[model samples]
Target: MPDSVLVAYGTTNGSTARIAEAVAEVLRRDGLAVEARPARSVTSVTPYDAVVVGGGLYTGRWHKDARRFVRRHRRALAERPLWLFSSGPLDASASERDIPPVAGVRKAMDRLDARDHVTFGGCLEEGAKGWVARMILRSGKGGDFRDFAAVEAWASRVGAELVGEWERSR
Candidate 1:
């Protein structure tokens, strides 16, 4: 049987969730069974052969839910093939060039031995939950900056690599 993969994300205004869903779709196309879920809602990571965790960047920090999910499932995550991602740069920078993960994410990657990390653009729209989000929208800096093409390309690479590894093992 093919391996089941989990794509979990933490999002404040829902953009990160969309990115995660896009990633999952690519992985599915690559022949892996994939599930995309909110990081906070996932009860366990034991069922998945590999994991992709993503969060929205917030004030130089990763989203709280993603951080907590990693902390809570550290042991399980460490044993799995893991990847991390952060989305938050309300501009074209992410599409233009690579953006490094934040400090906490770097530490988590090191400790968990994650295979890769990526930073995609973010979105700030009206009705976003926090005062900060509202302020950004008020300033006219809010728009959907996520590049689905880039996101799918990255995910295809990941899915290809994972599938190759699984095939070789069998």
Candidate 2:
């Protein structure tokens, strides 16, 4: 197994959590010890050698808890390698060229000095959403458009990076 890795994520309706689990699976398959947990579940960053932080987007903002987590552990995160990702942009057709960084994400990238940052498409369930979220879904503004293949590919890249880091340290 490779060095311990923490895959922490924040979700609104659970899409981000699903993405985090998928990422953790990819790392595990690559032989890394990975732990996937919600932002609130993480009491400290002292155990993990590397961290991957993810969150869902709402109104051009990441979940507040995620932002706070990063801010709280910025020092520990900076000492180790850290990556950030966001699940947003409802339109599946929009490529990376079409989607610019959301303000919150951009700010976090700077604050965390993240090694990498990515944006993934998110999911919207019309039937399961609350009034406000359902309205957003019904308005045709948000939809379930996550690209699992891309997510997997990115996870592979992360795995590669972790392996490389492990090798270098030895």
Candidate 3:
């Protein structure tokens, strides 16, 4: 049977979802069954061999839904391979440390024993954000800052790791 992965994400302006889809596509191409969706839409993680959770970053935090998802499924997630990512940097060139995953979720990541946590670049659309969000984005960053090539490289690495690990276990 093919290995299956669940890629769940939370996005306020949709950039994180796009990143999640890219990750899922790379996993699918690597011959894994992949289910990509918003965090709210996922009710369970037990059906898959592995799980990936990602979210948009805001005010140095991940969207609430993504955090809640991890909290709710903490036990189930702990039993399987779990990976995390956060997309919030408006500068595609920013290093992951400069746009780290919400520090608050470290407990959840630890409980789930996540294999990896990545910080990817994000995108901001014109006028799609509220005043606060706009103001935040305007603090010297805007436009589509997502680096598809970089995202793809990370996803490819993830895919290879998952495949190799599964094979070794089998």
Write candidate 2's Cα lDDT for 31-149 as tens digits.
99999999978989999999999988888888777888888888898888788888877887534544555787788788778888888898888664568688877788877788888
Instruction: Estimate, for each residue in 13-101, the C-alpha lDDT of model 1 and write its tens digit.
Output: 89999999999999999989999999999999999999999999988999999999999999999999999999999999999999999
The model with the greatest TM-score is: 1
Q: State the displacement of the C-alpha of residue 131, model 3, in Å, after optimal TM-score superposition.
A: 2.6
The TM-score that candidate 1 achieves is 0.97
lDDT of 3 by residue, 79-132 (tens): 888889888777755544454456766667877789888888878877756786
Candidate 3 lowest-lDDT run of ten? 92-101
lDDT of 1: 0.94
Task: Please report how far candidate 2 places residue 85 from its true position, in Å.
Answer: 0.6
Candidate 1 vs candidate 3, lDDT winner: 1
Ranking by TM-score: 1, 2, 3
Best by lDDT: 1
For each candidate, the alpha-carbon lDDT, in order, equals 0.94, 0.84, 0.83
Q: Which ten-residue region of model 1 has the weakest summed lDDT?
A: 1-10
